[model samples]
Target: MRRQTARLYLAALSKYCGSRLGKLLGVGCGNGEFLAEASLKGFDVSGLDVSADAVQTTNTLLGREVARCSTIERAGLPDHHFDVCVCGYVIEHTREPLEFLSEVHHVLKPDGVLLLVTAASGSRPVTLENALLRTGFRSVEMMTSASRVLVLARARVRRPRPLVSVIVPVHNEHRTVARLLETLTAKELTGADKEIIVVESNSNDGSRVDVLRFAGTPGVQIVLQDRPLGKGSAVRQGLRHARGDIILIQDADLEYEIDDYDSVIEPVRTFQCAVVLGSRHSGNGKIRVFADQWLLGLVFNSGHVILTGLFNLLYRQALKDPWTMYKVFRSDCLHNLKFECNRFNFDVELLAKLIRKGHTPLEVPVNYRSRSFKEGKKIRVISDPWTWVWACLKYRVVSPYGGDCTRRTENEMGDVPDTP
Candidate 1:
């Protein structure tokens, strides 16, 4: 009865926090009962108990000496070492519960979750919530059962969060290049490490100078091309230098808003998706185009719909706008495939390659502001459409260099690799 109750509560608590698998520190580990159950559930379990006998017994039973004879506040564990900190029926007995929580918070990595279980009296949920928030927790919630109160709180910032590489491909975007850098560098990205890699192609408008201004800035890499090689080539170069868990593509132009960055990176961060593409056609059914006042607008919209329809039919996937500049994907998806084109066909190639690898991108509605041709809009109606169509057909039928012609089912297409 005792082990069952502890296992049930711990399982529920772990699920409520995030997952059952991580480096877990169980405060007040008594006889290794709960930690044993947690270890079976895939947690890298360790323990702290004030009783030396209890700690020794736990270490003996678990077959390894993971349990230490120490209290929560003075356990002397390494900082930011654990993905989760669990205190079951220990906080209530601590001389200083606030200090205990602070210690636990210190040991947890940024974005790590802390689970607390205690008798459902004395320290009410309201008090516990305030205490946790005051000690650097971003959010806190409590669940009540017949005899226990379970609290879950996530650390405000992890010390070493996964880096997100932002690849900006630019050509003659001198006007907006500075603003783009400022926005990318100055934004407060919670629970994320950031790297900015800017690939600037040949531009006579002093765009190189604009990019050079951030030359020595931390976490920023600048690549200047002597001659214009097209956006695809610049992006491919940027991807080569990228060192991040998540790769995000941004345009040098200001048409796509930077404020949608959170939404763009969320799906990949939460592991809910392997690829997310921002759709210019997603929200309100209203769109902007360089020639909205002319027939070009109608032509562009029709082309988008027809091409997108064909893409869906061929790949058997639903993608709203595959041409959008705001595409975020896991770094692994780029593996085992080679990019041939260095032009705008890059977009079609990217989508086709990902689909062939069984990665279907989810579309998130993003805000878009169109620029007129006089306002520096690129891409002509006649030539680019043919290039896009050819890319779609070529990749759809022919095998990419060093790629498989046999398509795998969705299950075979693995998701993001697990992070311990």
Candidate 2:
């Protein structure tokens, strides 16, 4: 019966941990049978049992001093030292299950795996699963037979936090640029390391002076262009200087909330999606328009609906607010692609090309406060919509592969065509 159970434990380990074999600890290793089997399978095995007789028997069976007679809580094991831990029929006997699980958690490396075996009648799978989660285990799996339940879990691995490059394109609006910079530079706003790239396009409204104030600031790079270029042109310049794992686009205006940065970047950080767009109309059915400029708001909102619908149909997507300013994505996702649009149509071109390259963006709901033309809203109502339509059609049909017309090998940053 012990031999059969040892085989079962080994099988579970193989299924979860793959072919990788390393140091393994056996909790309450009875007579060293499981430890012996694990040792033969290329694992450097150690065992802990409270019973001195069992420990002696295990050492005698293995012909080595592998088993130690001590409780796991008082075992004096090194933290994050083991690769795999096998608790065979031991958890059910512990007085404090949470403490026992936590001790196990402490002894294993961040990427370590744990195999726990318990009697099916003694504990519920859901109860055990929850306890494992509380003890910092993720990717938990359970295998059940008629008599026993085998639980496989991995320790929550700590990956290095990614660097995020925030590209803020400044065009006029001195009133909000300084305040926006303050909110962005706050360290508590995000978990990832951040570098703020301010592309000042010779703003006539003193926005350049405000941006220049942060010139020597740590993690801030300021680029002063000779003349006022479009938002897309500024963003392209910022991209050349961006040195981040993830790239994010931010408008100089305060229409989008800085607080939503985490939510917008969460999908990319968690590896759930390659690209994320902070959609202002994700949950709200009503169109968000500037209340002060009601008539222009109505026209702009109507245009948004028409453009968004057209884009969705053309790209085979169901995205809400495709032209959102808050576009967050991994920098590598832009590899082998070229960007050309040098105006507001760049928004349409970027999203369309990304979709064509198989990166359907994940839309996350975000807070938005629309600003009117009087408040420095730069999008032209008449000509911009036509350009956006042309961009939607152009990028949708363009081949994503080959040639100077489609691909450019100039640099990893890709080519940005001059404004026509």
* C-alpha lDDT of residue 142 in model 2: 64
Candidate 1 lands at a TM-score of 0.59
RMSD of each: 11.7, 13.1
Best by lDDT: 2
Tens-place lDDT per residue, model 1, 51-134, is 899999899988998999888677678999998887878887778877878899899999888877777657555456556755
- What C-alpha lDDT does candidate 2 achieve relative to the native structure? 0.81
Please report, as a residue range, the 10-residue window in candidate 1 with the lowest summed lDDT.
Answer: 411-420
**Cα lDDT for residue 380, candidate 2:** 81
Please provide, for model 2 over 1-420, each residue's C-alpha lDDT reduced to its tens digit, 9 standing for 90 to 100. 266657756875796679878889999887898899999999999999999999999999999999999989999999999999998788889999999999999999887999887777867665676577557676666655545667788887433667899999998979899999988887453568889999999988889999989989999999989997688888988988987768999998899998899898878776667789999994544455777878887787777888889999999899888989999987755644677778898888778877765567999998888887887788888798899999999888875542332221224212322110
